[model samples]
Target: MAKSEQTKAKIIDVFLGLTNKKKWDKISVKELCATMGITRGTFYQYYNDIYDLMEQIEDTLITDLNHRYQLLPLKSPNGLFPPELFDSKYDYSPPQELFVWFDFCKNHQKAVSSLLDTKNGDAYFVKKLKVILAQHINHIMDYDGMPRDGLREHFTKIFIELHFMAARTWLDSKEEDFLSIREIINLLNTMRVGAGFLSNKQMTSPDFEAKMKFPADREVL
Candidate 1:
């Protein structure tokens, strides 16, 4: 890499290291420069301030994440998957994109973990991730012929929140023997399928129809 690019990367690396050691708000440009044996002027050339540096880092990560997700072959020109692809008789395989996403997370575990830390991390960054996940989930639900009504909308919100939190937990684990990406994907798929089954069963129940009615329309208990 060029000298300037290397310097910038080194700066980011130092910042991420500091993030792991202390709360984000407590990290200062002076300390970062001192740690890197660089002058404040050099830091200012690359970043306006600490917050600016953080915003740039987060923007880059989120942009890359969104691009990766957009590349998933969830739909064709018609914006829907082949109906047969959903058939129970057909053997199903997990999308390579999922593996890619998890691998990215693993590779950037330091940055991701630091940024997603509950107490000190950026909530805005987490919100951006959820937005990406929500879009992806909506596309999958669309292709799966799931209704986009109130109940399903609420379910989708819950689903996104659950998976995002699980991902954060996985990233936060310090153990070397944490679940592998493929295994986690399989578990997630199982949860999704189980949820779908319960949703279908619930929708088919007679009580579901009655529950859908206006509260006042129901017979008084």
Candidate 2:
């Protein structure tokens, strides 16, 4: 990596570390730079302000999750139809990448959750997540029978709602609610099913075992 990019990453790291330790509002650039052994000028070269760093962190987290999902060896639900839906290899199992994601969100619960409250309907994060889910569903299901635009709109809203709710819980859980990757993946799978974003064949995947898994428990969601 370039020295500039590396330095910027280190700065982000320092910011995230501090964020985990205290509220974002309480942490200052001076403290972050001091913790990272960087000068204030060096920090400025990478970020305009603390808000910029926060934005960067949020963007990076979502981007990383999407990228990781693309790399997963998911089996399309083309052949899995009703009565046994969600039986595809894409069983809601989160991969290694997702665990890292959970850790990040859990550590920065307050700051991250605050953003969700501020930017629910209009946030780029929510929009990007919609697009991500739409594309994935398109590949795994046959949406040609329905109005694509309508499906996208409905599915997006459901996805965002579930994600935000689960994210909030994951961040604020008092018990060992930190879910495994499979559990999170299952939660997502359930949401997609509940939103009616499945192919005819996918609607019968043996994985679902009769829509019995909808509205997963608190731990999974």
Candidate 3:
């Protein structure tokens, strides 16, 4: 990449690093620029605002996940919800990506919490999930008798929104409630199957509520 492009990428890395250490409000563009020895003008040249950088990070993460999924031989019954999907063998374990993300949140707990303080964050995740799930469903659904138009869209939205809400709640919890990436994958599978994206037999165990709980030692009063 050219020097300017390289600088812009470095700026994004610095911003995400800081985001892990502090809240968004606590992050100062001036400081970020100073740390990287760049001027505010250079920062503005790349992004309209801090939130723009955030959106970029979110988009990049999603893109990376999609790319990772494409490389794996996910052809079996358990392929969709397999815990091994995040293993290091593929150079991109889902759980490791999640850990990196959650650790970023934990590092910048105060700032990250504020982002989730409103419905906007939740809504954004829901919308993104809806799009992803819709595509995934269409790729795997039994369409012979299935309604191929409006009903699929409706089901996709509702199921994705519900899963998005649950995921946000799990990630934003004060305690380290979500310990396993498999649990998250399983929950997502249940949501997809329940929404008719997959066959009923494809659904995992039904005791999802109990399974979604925090560790016994980490329970809050």
* Top model number, lDDT: 1
Q: lDDT, candidate 1, residue 78?
A: 27
Candidate numbers, best lDDT first, in rank order: 1, 2, 3
In candidate 2, clashing pairs total: 18
Per-model TM against the reference: 0.79, 0.50, 0.46
**Candidate 2 residues 1-221, lDDT tens each?**
99998998777666655655566656788998889998999988878888788777777767766666667675533442343333443333333333444555665565466555432312665566556655655553442232344556666566556666777666556657576545775777665554444543444466654564465565476
**Residue-wise lDDT of candidate 1 within 1-221, one digit each (tens)?**
99888998999898988887787768899999999999999999989998998999898888888777767665632233333433452223554545656776877887887888877777888888878777776765554455567766787788776666667878877657577677888876665566554455455666866665678755575
Alpha-carbon shift of residue 67 in model 3 (angstroms): 1.2
lDDT of each: 0.73, 0.59, 0.54
Candidate 2 TM-score, C-alpha based: 0.50
Ranking the candidates on TM-score from highest down gives 1, 2, 3
Whole-model lDDT for model 3 versus the true structure? 0.54
Question: Could you tell me the C-alpha RMSD of candidate 3 in Å?
Answer: 11.1
lDDT by residue (116-160, candidate 3, tens digit) is 444333346335645655665554443212335566667656655
What candidate 3 gets wrong by more than 4 Å, as runs, is 1-55, 72-129, 143-150, 174-176, 191-221
